[model samples]
Target: MERTGRMETITYDCIREAAARLKGAAHRTPVMTSRTLNKQSGREIYLKCEQFQRGGAFKFRGAYNTISRMTEEEKQRGVLAYSSGNHAQGVALAARLSGVPAVICIPTDAPPVKLAATRETYGAEVLTFDRLTTDREAFGRQVAEERGLTIVPPFDHPHIIAGAGTVALELLEEVPDLDAVITPIGGGGLLSGTSIAAHGWNPKIRVFGAEPKLAADTYRSLQEGKRVSIDPPSTVADGLRATTPGVLTFPILQSHVENVVLVTEEEIEDAIRFALLRLKTVIEPSAAVALAAVRKGALPRDCRKVGVILSGGNIDPSLLAQLWEREATKI
Candidate 1:
C-alpha cells in the first residue's frame, strides 16, 4: 500500500505527530451513544462528539496544527483565511493562542454565532462577502498578498488533513473495534483524514461520508471519479456546503473513501431534532447528517459497530427556534 502521488503528506505519521502536538491543547471530546438510537439502527453507534471541541468544531485541530508549525517570521506576518463559519473561528482562536494575527473572510449569511465568536471571542479581523457572488479563495489570496499574510485554507492543506485525522485515531483508540466510520464531507478534509486514520489503524474498517443532498459535490465527485462543481449550496447544513472537493482531498478520498451517502434536507433536520430530544444533545445540521445516515439505514445491516462524527454544534439560537417551529408543524 505505497501511496505515491498526491496525499503523501497526509499520512499516518503526519497525523500521529499532529496528535502529539494537540495532546494537551485540544479537548479529547467525548464519545457519546444513545441506547434509543442504537436500538432503532440495530448497531452500536459511537458518536465522536466534536461539538464539544474548541471553536465548537473539529476545525480547531487543523487550525492549531497549521499555525503552531509556522516559522517565527511567518507567525509574525500573520495568516489570512476564508471559511463559511467553523474554520474561521478555528483559525481565529488558534492564531490568537499562537500570538499571530488572523484575518478571516466569511460569508455575509454565515451563522451569527460563528461570526461573533470569531470577531469578539478571538479578536480576529473579519471580512464579509456575498457567498454566491464572490470567490472566497481569490479574495483571500488578494488580501493575503496585500498584507503579506499566509493563507490558512479550510481543508485543502496537508497539515489540516493530518490534524483532522487525529479524530479517527482517538476514536479507534477508545473503541478499537469499529466496523465502519462515517463523517460529514465538506471540502473532504475530515473524511479524507478519517480514511487514513481508519485504514492505518485497521485496514478492515470501512470509511464513508454523509452529505446533504443540496450540497452534494463530494457525492458527485466520487461517482464521476473526478472533481465536480455545483452552484453555491443553499441548505440548512451550512457547514457542509462546499461547492467542490479540494484538489488534495479528492485524491485521498478517491483512493480511500468507500462511498458517500446523501441525506435530504428533511432527513438532516429530523436528525437535528432527534439529537436534541432523544440524545439530549444539540447538534447542528452539518453534524446531524452522519446520524441521519444511520437512522435512514444508509449503511449495510451488517455494519453492527459504527462510528459517527458529530462534527459541530454552533447553531444560532434563532435558527434553532425556526427549525423547531417548522418541524413541529409537520408533526
Candidate 2:
C-alpha cells in the first residue's frame, strides 16, 4: 500500500494511554485456543473473545474511552451517536456509566434485540431512521446540532480507534509471539487500531481485515487506492454493513493492514455454527467474518499462531432461531 500522507497521529503510545484509561473500566477479555480451529487451520489459533467484553462486544472499549473523556458541561449536555446495534449499546452503557444522557440514532431495521437493549436495557433515547433511504451521519449531525449533543461515531474518531486498538494491545500482551492478527472491519477503526498495535509490538507482525463479500467497501477501497462506496449491503452481518470506509481511518488502514479479505454470507453463517457447536462460544454474524476468512485461507502460508478478534457476540434471537431450525432440519 502506498503512503497517503494524511494519517492522523495514533502511535503505540496513544493505544497504551487508551489502555490506561480502560484498565479498570473495560474487561480484559480472555484469549482462548481452539483445538478444532488449530486442527482445521493447521496452525495454532489464538481467539481473543471480545464477545465476552462488556456490552457483549469490543465497541465498549471505544465508547467508554470516548464518553468518559467528555467535559463536564458536554456530559451535562449529553452525547449523540449512530450505529446499527453494538456501538449503540456500547455508547449507551458508557454514557450511563458516566451519568451522561445519550440519544442514539439507529436504523429502524436494526435487530429488535439491539433496539430494546439500547432503549429499555441501557435507558438511552432511541431514534429510528430508514437506513435504506436516509443518510445516518447527516441525520446524526443534524440532531447533534439541534440538541447540542457531542457525537461519538461508531468508528473513525481518533479516540475510538485508540480504544479499539486496546483489543490488540491486550492480545499481544497475553500472546506475545503471534505471527499475525485479523479482525472484522466496518469503517476501519478496529483494523486500523489492530494494525497499529500489532506492528507497534513487532513490526514483522502482519495485520489483516475481514469483510463480508457483500459489503466489501474497505477491500475495494484498498484495491483502488482511495475510499470506495457501495450500496448498503444486504448481508446477515448487519454490524459490518458500512457503505464506505471512514476518510480518517482509510489512510491508517492502507498504511499498516496487509490485505482485506472478503467472505461470503454462507461462510459467515458456517462460522457462527462452528463457534457454537465446535468452539462452544456464541458469536454474531459480524463477529464470524474473521474466522470465516481464516477458514477460507485468508492468512499467509507462513503465518502461525494467529490472533483473531471475535469482535462481538450479540446475535439477535430471530437469527439464532433460524440457525437452530436449520440445524434441526439437518438432523
Candidate 3:
C-alpha cells in the first residue's frame, strides 16, 4: 500500500480487503425494516443498524482495520487520534484489541457517555482540547511526532474510507435492488465509502448523504465544485458537526455521490424520536439525519427502495430527554 503523501488511493479492492479483514472481528450488524416507516415515506426502507456495532458505531470497522494492519514497530510505538466521540471509542477499542496503546484527543464538550466509554471502558489515555480554542489536528500531529505514535485520523485516510464502505457493501448485498442509499455525513468517510461500494456493486445505484443544515459544508462543497469550510458548527448532531469535508473523501463524493440532503435541527430531533418511539431503536441525532431526509421526502418521489445507514446510537440520555422535553412544550 503506497501513499502519495498522507493519503492513499482507495479502490473497490481495498474495500473488499477491508471486509475480509473484518470478517470475524466485526459483527455483521442486522438490516432492519419498518412497515410503518415504509408506509409513511412511501418507499421500501432498509435500515442498516450499526448502533449494535461493537463500539456502538460504524467507526470501529475503520479503526480495527487500520490498527490490525500496522507493522510490528508501529504497533509497539502505539497510535494517536482526535475525535469528538464515536471515533475516539473506535480507535481506543481497536488499539486495545490489537495490544497497542492509544492516546485519543477529544473535545471538552463531547458527550459524557462516549467520553467515559473511551477512557473508562476502553482504558485508553485521553486528552481534552477546547474545540473552539485549539487546533486539534496540529496538537495531534505534534503529540504523534514527539511520541513516535501513528496518527489514526477520524476520517481522510484510505483505510478508514475503505472500511466505512463495507457498511454499504453489506447493505447492497442484503437488498440488491435498492433504488438509492442515504447516509449521515460528518467528515464524509461514510458517504465516500458508501459511494464507492454502491457504485461498484451497481453503477446505477444512487448514493446520497444526509447533513445537518447547521453543518452542511459537504453540501456546499458539492455545489461549489471545491471543498468549502464553514464556521465551527453548533448542531445538536455532534457527530455531524465537521466543519469541512475530507480532502480524500471529497473527490470520491464529487465523482460518485448523487447529492446531499440538508435537514434542520428540529427534523433531526423528530427523526430521533421516531426511531425511539416507532422503530423501537435509539439513534443519535447524527444518525437520524438520514431518517429525517427519508421521512421529509428529500428523495425523489419515484425512488421506491432506499437504504439508510443509521451511523450510531451513542447519545447522552440527559440530552435526549431535554430535547424531547423542549419539543413537548410546542405540542
Quantify all predictions' global Cα lDDT against the true fold: 0.93, 0.93, 0.93
| lDDT, model 3 | 0.93
Q: Which runs of model 1 end up more than 4 angstroms from their true locations?
A: 1-8
In model 3, which runs have C-alpha deviations exceeding 4 angstroms?
1-7, 327-331
Q: Give the per-residue lDDT of model 3 (tens digit) for 143-205.
A: 999999999999899899989999999998899999999999999999989998898899998
Cα lDDT tens digits, model 1, 1-331, are: 1255644557888888999999998999999889999999989999999999999999999999999999999999999999999999999999999999999999999999999999999999999999899999999999999999999999998899989999999999999999999999999999989999999999999999999999999999889989999999998998988999999899889989888999999999889999998989898889999999999999988889999999999988898899889878988
The number of residue pairs in model 3 that clash at the backbone is 0
Per residue, candidate 2 scores C-alpha lDDT tens digits across 1-331 of 1233655688888898899999888999999888878989988899999999888999999999998888999999999999999999999999999999999999999999888999998999999999999999999999999999999999988889989999999999999999989999999889988998999999999999999999999999999999999999999999999999998789898899888889999899999999999989999999999999998887888998899999999999999989988888988
C-alpha TM-scores of all predictions: 0.97, 0.97, 0.97
